[model samples]
Target: MPLRQTIARYFSDHAETNDSHTDPLLQTHYYKITADKGVTILESLFRNDPLYDIHASSSDRGEISATITERKKAFIVATVTMVKPLQTAIDFSVTTESFLRFDLGFSHKVIQRLYAHTDKELPLVKNIEQQPAHR
Candidate 1:
């Protein structure tokens, strides 16, 4: 990890999944599922969890936003996109309520946990590992 990222992990209150993120765990995840199904699965997960209080969701846009009201306070948004018929992408953004914009990487941890939960409910299409190398 770079110095700046390490600093941000401990000193910042926000974290998000991006295509270019250095950490693969923090990168966008693809699964073999439809966008609507992905949205339903995630919404169900959040609704079932007592810690999560779902506030808004749009199946057409494939977005589900929720807030964590127990143990800590944090807002999270999960975006699902259909790249193809059965290929879907999921990404997360989390911001925690803390003083001095400090959550000790709480936002990052929350995203990781959410991903883990979602992963259990779907099959993730592995990224490019089996492709033949070309010179």
Candidate 2:
């Protein structure tokens, strides 16, 4: 199966639950990633500033969610829903490097530009509180 197809299937089979505390539907077995690089890249390309609130699942099928609060607004803006396999992370390291090499050789500046913007937005992302802290 293709990577995108597999990701879609994982989300389809999962159950979604509402999290009143964070005000987002929590899907079981997901990993939330709010990297600054990803945020900046999305905003520049999509014209949408990302808050990096992603609800995702891990390879083990454990449910999780994320919320990235905006500096001005005390709420999340970017909500992502998907599932990524553990193996993909490893594959990405090599594949991404290769892709970058190819792009650089061909003088394709798009990737460089995208990554630069993503770097700007990355510092704003922070993980959402998942557990109740004891006083």
The lDDT per prediction is 0.90, 0.29
- Which residue segments of model 2 deviate by more than 4 Å? 1-44, 48-107, 124-135
Question: Given candidate 1, what's the lDDT at residue 117?
Answer: 92
Find the 10 residues in a row with the least total lDDT in model 1.
Answer: 124-133
RMSD of each: 1.8, 17.1
Q: Give, for candidate 2, the lowest lDDT window spanning 10 residues.
A: 87-96
Q: Write the per-residue lDDT of candidate 2 for residues 1-135, one digit (tens) a residue.
A: 467544543333222223231212131212334333233344444344364344442433222233333431111123233324221100000011222222221111222333345435433222234456779
Model 1 TM-score, all chains together = 0.93
Structure candidate 2, residue pairs in collision: 28-63, 29-57, 29-62, 29-63, 30-56, 30-57, 31-56, 31-57, 36-122, 41-118
